[model samples]
Target: MHLFAMLRLILLGTTLLFSLITLGLAANLVDKLGDQWSFPGFAVAVSVLTILAVVPMIVIDLLRRGALMSWVVVELPIMGILWVLWLSSAALSTSVGLFLGDCSSFSFDSALESLCRQYSALQAFSWLNWLLVKTYVIVTLALAILALMKGHKRVWFSPVSDLSFSPTHTHSGEPKIPPPATAPGGYNPDPRMAHNHSASPSSGYPPNQPPTLYSPPSGQYPPQQQPYQSPYPNQGPAQYGSPVQTYQSPPPHAAQV
Candidate 1:
């Protein structure tokens, strides 16, 4: 898109330069010819040509940012103004082209012929003045029409960047996942899964043995055994009992003796 925009910028600059040159030459020609429409025509031409000069730069800049509407907004008026410029200049230059083309054939006073053929500064010898004006006029008209069309902008020069109205991401993001369907009694919808889900000890564990709520007698996890206690009475702890001190009582016979 930037490439396209840049190309458009280049085209615009080229057109702008052509337009400036044409405006200058045509204005000079009108001035030298001393035609009746020269004053007002040049006035409009100057103002419109200023717009022609300035707006393309603005449009090209706007295009880089993908401001299509903004570009259209400024460019629509530019197109309209260009239409006026084109038509006005076309009429003026076409008349001049005809005059210059036929001036030699027509029989007129020497002074009148001289005036008609007069070119003050590089008007006749440098290049064809009417041709430049006419070319610029046609170019302006073509660009104007192209600007008004929606698809033409992209086709003319592909913009490297652009704005889009459509959403880039889904509106609600990730889709919601539903719970798996169940049977009439809330069993799994699938028979195999339901069977696996309802495994029992008497029924035996499922062969694949997927996770389930039913506990079987130890297919994978064995029940832990508790240590057995000895049932004999002598088996209890006696080492830690208090030491009994038995006093040897003097025998009664000894005491009596």
Candidate 2:
């Protein structure tokens, strides 16, 4: 556990004990006096409220302390309210002359002296509880302010017990960096340059290798293409007309021999 957390628990335990004591003394006085005074009743009320509030918080700190359970938003307000309550109770007791005179002044009557001592005790414990709460609240607020200045904005909603008042890092304790882009065969490629080997020269691809031509896959041949025929053909002579008759020459030379 953190040192702050342990200290906080110790303070809470002490405050709870003080509140219980104050409650007992106040209740006893109120029962004996029977509404003759209002401060004792107010003290009883404050003590009851303190007990009711502190018990649940102690349980939370013990069993279910977490970001949500121990959130600053939740815890600080309760502490501040209790601090005010205890302060008011203590101030009221003092202003009502509960701690005005020495207990021995009432020595003429044993009962009066005992009651005076109890009143003094009640006032003392109320002040003590107020001091405890005030100290815790001031420390917590100071740490919160430090955390904010240090850029731990999440600490406002984070568990009080887990605050470090510093910038938190990843689990590995190093700043997170993105993985480099990689190509096949474990080749790390520069992100500023394209990885396409066949990209044009203007496209910023490296000119180390000449561009290759597209070819059919290995072990596979292209399908044979049929011969092309013209859509228009020449007309045949028989389709045009019959052959023209040729002029006949008689064999006149055989008669002369």
Candidate 3:
């Protein structure tokens, strides 16, 4: 469990880093492009769009992965995306304020300038951000729509718990189906009923065997026929230091009547 938690933490950290980088790039693009580029508000919209688009998919993916901490994994990506969006918004607002000369101009460090300058060189970076955001939105909506249309299917990738848990017939609050019936010619095995039956001839039986039939002695009157014949009459009962033939009989007077 501890190991699972640690793994979840690591995945969370990675997602956070991914979000931070995505937002950082977007912000830098906005800073360089300026408000005159005519799509200044697009980055904020895209950031929002990305969050709405990716979160549920990430949740579903984590669930499908069978993560022990799946909820945590889902939440981490969501929080990361939100953080990125928030950061991007802050950065864009600051840049816009500077552009309008309504706020104090902050000098960029060498690294910050380098990053912004990289984005500025591409007149297409602003469009690229919008494109990415739109693509994410479209794909996510398609997936969600597909899910709704399918109406909770029993997909192999889906969790077994989500599939049909209802019993077709119930017994004792569990699905009821008689245990597979014994094979037709097979012995009924019961350990506690206590009979010594063996699997091989050396072990007093043979594979796929039928029990040996006992033959009556030549002049023993063929034993009196009992009113009730035993199903396993060939299997004699232990008696008098030897096996004896036994069968069920009616009470004596009742039989005579």
* Candidate 1 stretches greater than 4 Å from native: 36-48, 51-72, 95-236, 239-257
Ranking by lDDT: 2, 1, 3
Whole-model alpha-carbon lDDT for candidate 2: 0.78
In the range 124-163, model 1's lDDT, one tens digit per residue, is 3223323433443454445534433423433223222222
Clashes of each: 4, 0, 1
Answer with 1 or 2, whichever has the higher lDDT: 2
Please provide, for model 3 over 1-257, each residue's C-alpha lDDT reduced to its tens digit, 9 standing for 90 to 100: 23323433343344334444545565665676666543345544645455454454446545565543233334334444644554554445445432332122324466555544444322233334434433333433344334334543323233212223221333232334455445455644444322454443333343466668788778977656759875664754466777555567879999888
Range of the 10 consecutive residues with the lowest summed lDDT in candidate 2: 197-206
Regarding lDDT, does 1 or 3 come out ahead? Answer: 1
lDDT of 3 at 74: 43
TM-score of 3: 0.27
**Where does candidate 2 stray beyond 4 Å?**
165-257
- State every prediction's TM-score relative to the real structure: 0.37, 0.63, 0.27
- lDDT of candidate 1 at residue 221, scale 0 to 100: 80
Model 3, residue 250: distance off in Å is 40
Model 3: how far residue 166 lies from native, Å: 17
